[model samples]
Target: MKSVNQIAVAVAVVGISVSSGFVAAQTKAPAVKSSTATQAKSSTMLKATMADVLKASQASDWRSLNPENTLYLEMDKGRVVIELAPEFAPKNVANIKALVKEGYFDGLAMIRSHDNYVAQWGDASEKREFKTAAKKVEGEFTIKYQKDTEFTRLPDADGYAPQVGHANSFAAARDPKTQTTWLTHCYGAIGVARGNETDSGNGSSLYAVTGHAPRNLDRNITVVGRVMYGIELLSSLPRGTGALGFYEKAEERTPIKTVRLAADVPEAERSKLEVFRTNTTSFKALVEAQRNRGGDWYKFAANHIELCNVPIPVRVVK
Candidate 1:
């Protein structure tokens, strides 16, 4: 049986042999060389090598996961990095921006966590009509594909779709039947809170994944972004037993002291971070090296990696 760490967490990768030596956390990382376009286009997908990947990953295959699309939920535990789906759901993203700007999530509570389902957080008030009107924003599934969203489809069999891969640093699956792409809710994944019809969230509520993959929630809720660095702060929280896993009383709830955008924070307090870009040779090489792990620790290599199981590593550079 897989242990809790294996069962509960999913992470990303970087170029070549770095997988075994990779460090992912809210702390610091040694300098990382970015990927370049020259290496990225040298050969077609199948012919690429680990060195080719690292060389391409030199300067071009790196992009700052945009701050405007980012949210930093500061809690007593730590920071949760959420990337918003602004293109897919503009209204929902805008509402979330407003709520963040207004400090709506500050002092609110994380009220629900259903194991094997989702760990949710938001205003737990019983005032349904009032809260409904405020957060009941519309949902938009027609997302304009951004130039930054360069997806590299995976070749393995997946329960969710014909092909599974990464785009914008999130686990993604594309339906050949419909050509639709959406974020897969892997562990530590973040999503907007909403009701049955969609467009029910005012961005006042949110959730983070804590258990098994819940692919059913993919297009149902507006997945703003995901916990890029500090997912442990949420997933390790004690589970609740009240309705929808809500703590029985206010006293048991975890308080969010503040939810601020990195852009809003002072430059000194911001997280100095970079994500190895998707579809680049370095990232491809990084994933491939781990996919087989020809390194010292393994007597044999798997030569296979699950879509959700792979981690896009994050580091704080000095």
Candidate 2:
């Protein structure tokens, strides 16, 4: 089994290498230093690594995760902290929270760990009764694009959506032509798994992206949130052997200890975490640094970054 640190490095490499649309299809341009870009004008960003950008960030550049909007998936390995984006999928978030309160996922098992895809967890028998959560929920694949939406759009081009950006700290995109906005299937995204019918996903069966950015699923499924911490715990699980990566035997499955709302957990037991806000100058600088990685190792800069390639950083607070 890989340690949490190893899994993070491996997953990050997968995210950067395999995510579609991360690199442009056009012919490779001549290598240019990152200093040539307009956004690189800031000395802090000019030829500076992402670490430098983060190190120079101010306290105002980060936002704390709300206890009510956080979920902790406890397992034998460790806890996976998820930051729910109720702003994008309010109904689903509400239902999931209700299910958590009812202890719906207390003793369930992770049924699937699809290689280069997702790690899913829920009642495999499909016989569990819902105490409060609805069995079906209308998909919130896309919402009406509001002018006041908190989005930090990437200037690069994307083949999947008209405009790719980050909204409410989640990777998202919007189409002004249709006035619609939806979350993308980025690495670490938590989504509801449904059957043939769109409304079948009721937050009972949830999955987190463990591999590359499955951008093809965007708007086709409901992405409720992202892993704010401990994604490695899910991504490092052994790949399932059955179809769609479902474990064939009960013994092969990893048991889920419990799923609890951070608000419900004791204050001392909760994670002291804060996420780097997307709508900040420091984050923008970080994006630029990623677009054109600094240091002496590279001869050229990519000069382009996709929605999933740009990482959303989280830090533990003292």
Candidate 3:
């Protein structure tokens, strides 16, 4: 009789052979029966893979991006789609929306592209003017943690905050002791650039994170939103040569054709996309699948996932 360890090895070997079609001589082993039967009868049933979880998700598991809260940054190459987080930075988002409607960023330039850091754009000139009245929004680095907030906590350790989770589809951190919650500086996170004063950022200068999660920036800067799609457009730009990745020569700055709110654009011109709702049962299953990769290719599961490693799925509305 084979030991338990030996049985597991035999099962793994059989699974690989069956998946790789090494037993083609067995009349192409029944596709469904061979795979499902073996796994189901095993003492330890394999967890569903990420692909399997996503495939089993229902239509209700996803939510459409609200056009009123979406922004499109148009450049020569393509448009970068951004989703605003009103729940976190309401005043900043409101000011940004007003600026977009007033055509404040119609001809501004992207003045900075730092390699593995950030891609920032705004009025680089000192004589820049706002077309509309820009409000002085106080720095909204963190908000009062409300119990009713829709937060889906993750079962993982984070070096930055005591507890990490997803709030309104945005990566976030919460401290129950202080009763405060703040957005994390995950990749693609958009923050308003400020000067010496905390309230200096008036929805004019904005930067998107292109590198790893700089969690230290949380609670230090006002993060307004995140780039939902077309991050490649900004990430692929040439890094500037001057200090802090600013373009040394004025001509090197990339021209921004326009920045418009999706709601302001014509219906046919708007981009249609949907994001997976993080508060759904399917999302929990998806998270579990990622924590422990269970597939024929994986010999051992890590049984762990980081806050930044979690991928929020987005798909075009067909």
TM-score of each: 0.76, 0.87, 0.84
Using lDDT as the measure, what is the rank order of every candidate, best first?
Answer: 2, 3, 1
| CA RMSD of each candidate after superposition | 9.2, 6.6, 10.0
List runs of model 3 lying over 4 Å from the truth: 1-45
lDDT of 3 by residue, 39-155 (tens): 444322277765677567788987878899999999999888899999899889888898888888888998999998899998888466666647577899988877888899999
lDDT of 2: 0.83
What's the true lDDT of residue 1 in model 3? Answer: 29
**lDDT score at residue 318, model 2, on the 0-100 scale:** 58
Instruction: Please give the distance, in angstroms, between residue 98's alpha carbon in candidate 1 and its true position after superposition.
Output: 1.4
Write one digit per residue (lDDT tens) for candidate 2, span 83-111. Answer: 89888899999999999999999999999
Per-residue alpha-carbon lDDT of model 1 for 43-124, expressed as tens digits? 2333433434444455466666578878888887767777675655677777778877877777787787676666678888
How high is the lDDT of residue 297 in model 1?
A: 30
Choose 1 or 3, whichever is better by lDDT: 3
Ranking by TM-score: 2, 3, 1
